[model samples]
Target: MTLAPVEYAVIEFGDSTVTGDLVPALTELVETGLVHVIDLVFLSKDADGTVTVLELDDLPEGTAAAFAGLEHDIDDLVNETDLQVEAELLSPGTSAVVIVWENLWAQRFSDAVLASGGVLLDSQKVPQDVAAAALAAHLASLD
Candidate 1:
């Protein structure tokens, strides 16, 4: 069967701490367009290593290959820069990022994300109205 296109989002929060309502947000995203909910990734890093795990209903079609490249790019940027970020993707269509702050690394991260055919939705860096719309749109999908 033809799978839905993956939509990704990287919500970069200013707090740098994990937030709740992720599931709800993702639900909204799927309900918006005709896209399927693919893999959801949480991009966090600590002393141990980087955390880039999926958190959505429909897992990405080509997760292994997509994530391999994503992992490499994420590692390189994190090691060379300071970006507390989180990434979430909705299969072939969209992705969002939440970052502590905006910096040059944003471009690099954006490139990596787009390369994977993901959109970079930096909630922290983006306008409040836009975020609200996204959140609202995502939430409305619950119905």
Candidate 2:
């Protein structure tokens, strides 16, 4: 089977809690076949900067239940090194979620490019702040 482009993200929360508020949006993406969740891990950093990785069963009952249905295609794809890197970015009292996903909708385009002998030499994502600033500048210039 052709593989889609995979991406990972670390989302930090101000506090040490997983409220499952994003479940609905995530479910919608999966339901619509836009993306497939590969792996998801929750982590928390204590006041002393100690990081603890939490399993799904370790979450609050409601949160655990909310994520129970989101299946991972491959487990532990986000390894210890990945977690350590993301943990360094979290504040002492904060928590974070590390998610790895495949862009399912891009599979067809990727396959077509490969079939046509096109090569992806490089790819990069602009930082959110940078992209937002660029958009704002472009809009202002048009005014």
Candidate 3:
């Protein structure tokens, strides 16, 4: 079987935003063949500098509802070291989620490129504001 390219992302949330707010979009991504969730971990830092890591099965009722009926390929791929990194970056009173996912839709294409002996270069996600600015500038120049 061809292996999907894996990617990890860390989402930091302010005290106001909760996991529930972000679930719908992520569910849609998985449903639309964007990616497969290999592991999802939520970390909350207490005022006493304690970070609690919650796996899918350990999620709170309200938080678990976010994954309502969504497919979770839970592989427990994110280990303690990953949690430690998240803990270090999270604020004492804030929360964050670390996600490890595979780009399922890109597997075949990536395999083909590899088969052709092509060296993969860099991949970067353009910041939303920068992309918007570039688009606006191009449109203005065309007008």
Candidate 4:
């Protein structure tokens, strides 16, 4: 099955902040058919942030196991090392979510980073060429 392309917002916060909201939003996105799953990348200040991605497969009733199969399809099409892989896994029907925690959401996390002074960065959505290159590169490296 072909995937859909979607857009999402990522909320970044400090250590041990309000991270519970992400799952529900992702679930909603999946339920609405806006996206199959969300790739959650966590960015933090000086602490050296690590990106952790979770595909929301616990879909609401009525929908097929599309998300269940998506993980493998995405993994096959995109290289694990490429950032675009996340975007590629999300079909045109799906979208990528970039959660950057800041004021209003996580004051402590926002304040801590500001005190130390860290900036949030956004990676551009996977363009066609970039996605193609990543796929091509993955295929080539396989040999």
Work out candidate 1's RMSD over C-alphas.
14.4
lDDT of each residue in 1-143, candidate 1, tens digit only: 22222224456434323444354544443355323333334444333344444332223444333332221112222321222323222222223332121233244565667679986465445778999999999999987
C-alpha-based local distance difference test score of model 1:
0.39
Residue-by-residue lDDT tens digits, candidate 4, 1-143: 22233334533343322234445554564455444432434222222323344333322232223233321223222233544434333333222334321112344565666668776565366778999999999999999
Residue-wise C-alpha lDDT for candidate 2, range 59-118, written one tens digit per residue: 889998998788777878888898888899999999888878899999999999999999
List the candidate 4 regions with Cα displacement exceeding 4 Å: 15-18, 47-143
Q: Relative to the unseen true structure, what is the C-alpha lDDT of residue 119 in candidate 3, on a scale of 0 to 100?
A: 70
The ten-residue window of minimal lDDT in model 4 covers 70-79
Write the residue-wise lDDT of candidate 3 on 10-64 in tens digits.
7878772346777788888898998887777788887777988876567768887
As a whole number from 0 to 100, the lDDT of residue 85 in candidate 2 is 86
Question: Candidate 1 — which residues are off by over 4 angstroms?
Answer: 31-33, 45-143
Candidates in order: C-alpha RMSD to true structure: 14.4, 1.4, 2.2, 19.4
Off by over 4 Å in 3: none
lDDT of 3 at 69: 54
